[model samples]
Target: MARVLTAKGAATRRRILEGAAELLRRNGTAGVSLELICQTTGSSKSQLFHYFPDGRAELFCAIARFEADRVISDQQPHIEDLSTAESWRAWRAAVIARYVEIGRYCPVNALVVELSRTGPEAEGIVLDMQSRWHTLMTQAVGRLQAAGGGCRHVEPEAAASVVLAAVQGGASIYQATGDFVHLERALDGVLSYVGVA
Candidate 1:
């Protein structure tokens, strides 16, 4: 059973998790260590173990979840309100700007890579995040069509899937070759298909 943490204990756990996430983002999974996390967060190994008894596996999974949340929350307001061409364009820009600013050090991707060989949990986390993200976009597409904003002939579910795939492909390209053009072009193509270009 999971331990029930007091408010103070929960806050401490959160502090450690956030600090570790920041370290992971700054250095990638390859460069971060638990000791570094302790030093950076001013937490002891005992505290970390108290919060995450499974040690690195548990802690890494927690970070993956945290980063996954960031992936969606970062695109807020625009992602939530895509009822017009203006909103769609803004959402596109928000997506591009976010990835561009990160410049390939995506903690979510890093954790996925780091934990892929370990087990299925990391993949599950990514899949869950993607599902939630795609659902939100799918709903946004439905909203646009219902509002008579655009995408009249487009299929909401498929369009949203394509948009999500475009982003993944684009981000992969950017991470692989540090090229931004392909991601932008891919997104433009999908947006055009959805009649928002």
Candidate 2:
């Protein structure tokens, strides 16, 4: 049976994960080494293996989950409160802030690239993230309709899809070009489509 860790052990494991996350972000997963993580975290080989017996692959999976959680968490209160007009603007601002803060550093994309070498898990993770993103947008649109803010003829689900695609596409472009015009244009386009601009 697997051993349960005490609070100190848990803290140690988290320290190791945080160190590994930084390393993975600075250097692609391939560029990170076990020794580098150990040195950076001051963790022994046994300790590392105690947390991740399967080795680098196990660590990578944990990082993938961490990054995935960050992806959603970064959206924050805006993501959960999209039920209002003010919330919509807040969400837009949050997205812009997050993108600018992160710049070109996309942990989820990096994880996908590294894990793709292993098998279907990478694709599954990507798809799961996408689904969660769509759900957030869809709920926001639904809230707009329930509040009678949406255009009478607009189809909430379809509009939500367009809006999400636009945001993601614009973010991708901004990541490459370092210009936020595309993101702005995409958000504006979505608002315009909804007759809200």
Candidate 3:
């Protein structure tokens, strides 16, 4: 059976997890041993094991989930209420601004790329994040169409895929080359077609 934690234990685990995330952000995946995490977080092996009994795999999965959630949350109210054309534009800007600010230091993308090579748990985290993001964009397209903002001729689902692809492709290029032009143009082109940009 799994161990149930009291509030203090939960807090301790949370601290360790967050500290590890910061360390990963600063150092990437290199030299990130459990011992390093313990030293950085002031956590003992017993405490780390008590929280993450499955060891490094368990902790990495947890970190992936956290990073995946950040991808969605970073888009914020814009993504949530993409009902209006303005909201869609805001969402587009948010997406670009986020990547621009983060530049090549996107740990979520890094974590996804790195951990995905390991196993299903990590792959599933990326899949879930993509699925939810696509669903939201698709739903927003439909709502915008109903509001007479989105192009009536374009299928909401297809349009969502286009924009999602644009964002994803553009982001990958930007993250690789540290250039903003691709992301900006891709988002603008797709968003303009969708009557948002």
Q: Highest TM-score: which candidate?
A: 3
Q: Which ten residues in a row have the lowest lDDT in candidate 2?
A: 110-119
1 or 2, which is superior by lDDT?
Answer: 1
lDDT (Cα, 0-100) at 164 in candidate 3 = 68
**TM-scores of all models?**
0.82, 0.80, 0.84
> Clashing residue pairs in candidate 1, if any?
none
Which sequence of candidate numbers ranks them by lDDT, best first? 1, 3, 2
Query: lDDT for every model?
Result: 0.82, 0.76, 0.79
Question: Going through the candidates in order, what is the number of backbone clashes in each?
Answer: 0, 0, 0
| lDDT by residue for model 2 (36-143), tens | 999999999999999999888778777777776787888897877665667777777887888778776655555555544544665566667767877887787777
Off by over 4 Å in 2: 1-3, 111-117
Candidate 1: worst-modelled 10 consecutive residues by lDDT: 110-119
TM-score for candidate 1: 0.82
